[model samples]
Target: MIWTFVNNTFEPEEKATLQTGDLALQRGYAVFDYFRTVDHVPLFLEDYLDRFFHSAQTLFITIPHTRSQVRAIIAELIKKNNLPESGIRMIATGGYSPDSYTPVQGNLILQQQPLQLPDMARFERGIRIMTYAYQRDLPAVKSINYLMGIWLQKQLTEKGLDDVLYVQNDLISEFPRANIFIITNGGTLVTPAHNVLAGITRKKILEFAGALLPVETRDISVAELKNAAEVFMTSTTKRILPVTEIDGIRIGSGTAGPLTRQLQEQFIRLQESVTTAPYSRA
Candidate 1:
C-alpha cells in the first residue's frame, strides 16, 4: 500500500521499514481502525476518524498527523489510489523502545486495500454462532490486539458455528467482530450498554429506529437472548445480519425476522444515498 503524510508528502521506503527493538518483539502496544467505502464514497468516515482519534487518546499513543491532517491524507490516499470501493485501515504502533514496558516513539501506518464482499448466502440463511467465556480486553477502544478472537475462530468453526459470541458471566456481550442486538418479547431492543464497542452501523440503526422501537441499552443475559424474538448483529463490513441459530437453538422461528429485514432495507437505502464522487483534497 502507498504511504502518505502531512505537507502532501509520500514515503517511498515505508513498505520496507521494520521495527527491531523491544517494542517490536515483546510489547503489543498498538491501536487501529478500519472502515470501508462503497462505490467510491466513504461510509461514515467522520465517525470512523473520530473514533480513531478517541482510541488514540485512550491508549495514550500520539498520532503521527493531526486530525485534520490525517483526514486530508485519507482523502488523498483514496484519490491517489483511485479506490472506487475499498477498505481503509489505520494503525499506530508504540514504536521502538529500549525496554518493552515503555515506548520511545510511535509509528503510524495507513493502508487502503481492496474490499472483499462477504458471502451473501450467510446473510440470507443467517449464521450460527457459538458462545465464548472470555470478553474483549478494552471494550471501548479498537485495538490491534485481537488474540481472543483469533484463538476462538477455529474452535467456533469446528463446532459448526459461523462466529463466536462472547459471554461474560451470564450476560451475552457481543460477537467476535460485530455488535449484537436482541428484540425482546415485549418489543424492546435490548443490547449491551457498556463494555462493548459502539459500532457505526449499530449507532445508525438505533438512530433510524428512534422512538419507533423502545431501545434499551443494558446487559442482556444469555437466557434472555435465548428467548428473544429476533437476534441480529451489526458491523461496518457485515452491515446488519440475522442470527438464526445460537449454539444449535433456533432464534425467532430460525429465520430473519420482519424487524431485522426492515432495518436491513433502510440501511441499504442509507448507503445508496451517500455521495461517492471522488473527494477533492481540502
Candidate 2:
C-alpha cells in the first residue's frame, strides 16, 4: 500500500503526478528536506520542518499549507503506506506558471519509501570518500540543484566510492549530501563553520560531541582533513559514517578510528530514543 502525498492529496506512489509546467520541472526551482521514521513515527521531524520552511522562505515560495498541516499529512502518509521504518522527503517546488521564470505558487510533495541504510559492515570498516574542489551555489539552501554531483557520479561509481566531500580554495566545504567532521589527535573535534548546509544531524553531533570532546567550528582545509586522526560524515540517512580513505589517502589506520566509533555508538543511543516514542497515527 505504498502512497504519496502530492499537493495535499494521497494517492498510490506510482499514480502520483506533477505538471510539466511547474517551475520545478521547467527551471528546477524547488527545496527539499529529508527525515526518517522509526516504528512509523517521524524522527526529528520538527527540525526537518524548520529547515524546509526556512528553505521556502529563502526561495520566496509561500508554502500552501501551515507546518501543522504538513505534519498531519506526513502522519497520514505513514498510516496509508504501512511502512514502520521509512525515509520521508518533503518537497516544496515552484508551482506551475504561465511564464516558467515566474513563481506564482508552491507545490508541496511528500514521498515515503524504505529508508535504505548502509550495511553495518561499512560502519565498522569505514567508507572511501572522493574529494572535488567546488562550492555549491547558495550553500545554505536545500535546493534541487545537484548538477555538479550528478555530473561526477560516473567517476564516483567507477571507483566504488561511498560519497564526495566538496572543497573550495584549499578549504573543505561539505559533502554533496552530508556534513563532515574530524577528530584531531589533540582530542579536538573540528568541522567547517560556513559555506555549507547546517544539517540537523551535524547540529546534534556537535551538541553530543561537546560533552565528550572539545568541538571547534571553523574553516577546515583538505590538508588538515587528510592528516586528521579521524574523520566522519553526518546526515539524516547516513548517520555517522567514518571516512577511512579520502582521494587515495588512507585516513588514520584506514579503518573506523576509535573516537569515530565512540561517537557512532552515542548517536545510535540518541536515535533510538527519538525513534521509540509512540506516534499518534501508529
Candidate 3:
C-alpha cells in the first residue's frame, strides 16, 4: 500500500496546475529527503523534516506546507493506513517554469511505502564496492538529479560489485547512495567532511561515538582507505554496514570489525527505546 500527499491532501497525483515537463524533465532543480520507521514510528523524524525544509530553502524552492503541518500530515497518513514499518519521501519541485532556466512556482509531495531491509548476512560478511570518479552537482541538497548514481550503478554491476564509492582526485568522497567511513591504523574514525550530504544516521553515530574514540571529519584518500583497519558506510535504511572489500581488495581482515558491530548494537537499542502510538480512533 502507498499513501501520497499533494497540496496538503491525500491524492494519487499532483495538481493540474503543475506542468509535467517542468517538474519531471527539468534536472538539478529539486530537493528531497527519505526516512524510515521501525513500527509506524518515524525515526529522527524532526531531523529529516528540518533537513527537507532547509534543502528547499537552499535550492530556492518554496515548500507548500509549514514544518508542523507536514508533521501532522505524516502522522495522519501513518495512522489512516495502519502502516507498521514504512519509508517516507518528501519532495519539492521548482514547479512549472516558462523556460527551463526560470522557476515559476513550487509543489510538494509526500509519499509513504512499506519498508524493506537488506539481508543481514551482507552486513556481517560485507559487500564488494567499486570506486568511480563521480561527484554530486549539489552536494549539500538531496536533489532528484541522480545521473551520477545511475551511471555508477551500471558500471559497478558490470564489474561484479554491489555498489560504487565515488572518488575525486584519488580521495574517497562518498558511496553512490550512502556516506563512507574508515578506521585508521591509529583508531581514528575518519570520514569525508562537508562536501557530502550530512546524513542523519551518520550524525547519530558521530554523537553516539563521541570521545569514545577519536573521530575526525576530513578528506580521506584512496590510499589511506586501502590501509585502514576497517571501513563501513551509513544511511537511514542501512544503519551501519562493513565494507569488507573495495575493488576486490580485502578491507582489514575481510570482516565486520569490533567497532562497527558495537555501533550497530547501540543503534538497534536506541531504536527500541522510541515508542510509536497509533492515532486515536474518531
Candidate 4:
C-alpha cells in the first residue's frame, strides 16, 4: 500500500481524496513540480521545491506548508512508501472554490511511485518529433494546463512521432515536456531563450556544457534547426536525448552525434556524483 501526502495529512493512497469543487478539477487551475529519487534520496529536491513554490505564487495559490514542513512530509512519505527508485510529484491546486472559479487556500499533495528511466537504447537510437505552431499560456509557470499537448497525442500516434516541438513565427521554442538544443554546423551549441519554461535539466546542461563547447541561449529559427549538425532535448526523465529526426528529415547522420554522446557521459557522471554524495540543500 503506497502512502500519499494530501491536505496536510498522510494517508494510504487508496484513501486519499480531494474535494470535487477544487479548481484543479473544475477549472484545471493548479501548479506542479516533479523530480526523481535514486537510492531513496530525492535528486535535486531543493530545486524542485523552489520551483513548486514559485509556480504556486505565480498562480496566486497558497501552499499551506512551510519549506521545512514540506521537506519533512516528503521524507515521511518516502519512508512509508519505501520506493528507492521513484518519481515524486508536488502539486498545489486552488482549493475548493465555492463558486468554482475564485481561488482559495490551496491543497498541497505529494505522491510517490516507482519510476523507470528510459532505456539505453533510446539514447543510442534517438527519437523523431513533429513540429507544432503553438505557444503555452504563462510559459514560465508549471501550471496544470497541458490541453494542447494532450490533445495532440492522437496525431503523434498516427504520425509515428515521439513528441511535439513548439514553434512560433518561424522560431523554435521548446517541446511540450522538454527543452530543445542544437549544434550548428560551425560547432556551437544553442537553445531557445524566450517564451519557454526554463527547465532544471536545461539549466544544469547550460552549467556544464559550456566547458565542453560554445553554448548560447537565443532564438533559433526553424531553418537553422533543420540545418543544424545535431539536435537533442533535455528533461528530468529524458536527460540528454538526441533528436535524430525532425518532421521526417534526418538530423545530421540520423543518430546520436559524437558531441551528444560526450555530453550524455558527462551528465551520467554528474548524476552518479549527486547520488553518492550526502544530500544537501547547498
Candidate 5:
C-alpha cells in the first residue's frame, strides 16, 4: 500500500489527485525538493526544507504549512507507510490559477516511493558522464523546468551515455541533477561556486572532506576538469558516484580513484550516525 499527502491529509495514491487546470499541469510552474529516508528517518531534513522554502520564495509562492507542521506531516507519512526506507518528494506548486501563471494558492504534495540507487557494483566500477552546454534558468531554484534534460534523451541514448554534465562558456556548471566535484592534480577538492543548485549531499560531502584534505569551492573550468586526477558527482539519490570518463575521455585511469572511495566510505559512516529524532516531533 502507498500513501500520498495532498491538501491537509494522507490518502491512497489513486485518490490523491490534482486538477487538469492546475498551474503545475497547465503552465509547468512549480518548485519541488526530494530527500530520502534511512532506517525510517528523513536524511538531512533541515537542509532539504531550507532549499524547499528558498525555491518557493524564488517563485513567489508561500507554503501554507509551517516548518513544524511539515515535519509532523512527514513523520506521520513515514509511520503510516511503514516503508522504512523510501524516496520522499515534496512539491509546492502554483495552485489553481485563473490567470494561468500567478500563484493563487500553493498546492503542496508529499509523495513516498521505494528508494532507488545504483547497484553496489557501479560504485566499485564507477560510471561514465557525457558533457553538454546549457545553463539552467534561475540556477539557484529547483524548479519543474527540465525541458533540456528531457530534450537530451535522444542524444543520451544514441551516444550510449549514462548521464550528461552541462557546461557553459569554457567553465563547467554541473550535471542536470547532481553537483560535480573534481580532484585536481595539486590534491584539492573543487566544485562550482555559482550557477548551480547547492545540494545538501554536496554540502555534507564538502564538510566531511574538509576535515581530511584541501577543499576549494570555486568555478571549475572545462580545461581544468579534463586534467583532474579524479572526478565524481553527488546527489541525494546517488550519494557519491565516481566518474571514470567524460565526453569519451578517460578520467584517472578510467576507474574510481582512492580519494573518491575514501570519501564514499566516510559518507556512509556519517549517515549511519544520523538519528530519527529532532527532525520530527514523533
Candidate 6:
C-alpha cells in the first residue's frame, strides 16, 4: 500500500487529504523541496532539508516539526514505503486559514513518488531550451509557484523544445526547474549568483569543478551565454545536463563540449559515493 505523511500521520496515499480551506488549496500557497533516493538511501538529504526549512520560513509558514523530528519522520516514511529508488517531496503549506487568505501555522505533507531522472539519451545528446524573458518572484524560495513554467509547456511542445530558459534584464537567469551554467570561451565555469534558486546539485558542481577550472557566480548576459564554449544545467533530477541549443542558437559545435563531458564524469563518481548516512553540508 502506498503511504504518505499528512499532518504528522502516515496514511494510505489515497486516503491522505488536506483541508479544502488550506491556503495551499485555497490560494496555491506552499513551499516544497524534493530529493531522490538510490538503493533506499536519500541523496544530499541535509541540504534538501535546509532548503525546505528556508522555503517554509520565506513563505511565512511554520513547520510544526523540528529539524531532527522531520529527519526522523522522513526515515520512518522511507522505511514504510519501501521504495528503494524514488523521489521524496516534502511540503509545508499555509494552514487552514480562518479567512482563506491570511497565512497561519502550516501543515506538513511528505510524499514518495517514482524517480524520473533525465534519460540517458538526453545526457548524451543534450537538450534544447527556448529562452523566455521573465523573472520569477521570490526566486530564492522554492515555493509552489510554477504557473509560468506549467503554462509554457504547450509552447515547449509546439516548439519541439525540451524546456524553458528564463532570462531577465538581458542576463541569463535559469531554467524553469534547474540552475544553468556556462563554460566561457576562456575555459571558466560560471553560473548566476542572483535571481535563481540555489540548487544543491549546483553547489556540488561548483565545489568539484572549481579545482579544474576558474568558477564564478555572476550575471551572464544572453550574448555571452549563447557564445559560451559549453552550456549545462544542474538539479536533483538533471545532474550536469548539457545545453546544446538555446532558442535554436547552437552552443559549441551544436553538441556537448569537452568540459561538460568532464564535469558529467565527475558528477557520476560523486553519485556513486552517496549513502544512506546523513550528509554534511559543511
List per-prediction Cα lDDT, in the order shown. 0.79, 0.89, 0.80, 0.90, 0.88, 0.89
Q: Least lDDT summed over 10 consecutive residues: which range in candidate 5?
A: 273-282
- Note the residue pairs that clash in candidate 6: none
Per residue, candidate 4 scores C-alpha lDDT tens digits across 1-282 of 998899768888899889888899999999999998888888878778888999999899989889899988888888899998899988999998898998899998999999988888988899999999999999999998999999999999999899999999999999888999999999999999998998988888889999999999999999999999999999988889999999889999998999999988998898788988875411
What TM-score does structure 5 among the candidates reach? 0.96
**lDDT at position 5, candidate 2:** 87
The sequence of per-residue lDDT tens digits that candidate 3 reaches over residues 1-282 is: 455887657864333234566654575577899998777788888889888988888888888778888889888878776768788888788877667766556777788888777677878898789887878877878888888788667677677888888888888888766999898988888889957988998888888776468899998888998899989999988888999888779998898998888888887876666543344221
- Candidate 6 Cα errors over 4 Å, as ranges: 276-282
Worst 10 residues of 3 by lDDT: 273-282
Model 6: how far is 120 from its true place, Å? 2.5
| Tens-place lDDT digits, model 5, residues 163-265 | 8989999889888889999999988999999999999999998888998689999998888998999999999999999998888888987878888888988
Q: At residue 202, give the lDDT of candidate 5.
A: 93
Q: What is the lDDT of residue 122 in candidate 6?
A: 78
TM-score of each: 0.90, 0.97, 0.92, 0.97, 0.96, 0.96
Candidate 2 local lDDT, 27-66, one digit each (tens)? 9999999998888888888889999999999998878999
Number of the candidate with higher TM-score, 3 or 4: 4
lDDT computed for candidate 3: 0.80
Error of 4 at 244 (Å): 0.8
| Predicted structure 4: lDDT | 0.90
| lDDT, residue 23, model 1 | 51
Per-residue accuracy of model 6 over 1-282 as CA lDDT, tens digit each = 979998879999999999799999899999999998887788888899999999988789989889999888888888898888789999999998999998898999999987877777878799999889899999999999999999999999999999999998899898889999999999999999999999999999988998889999999999999999999999898888999999889899777789998998898788777763356211
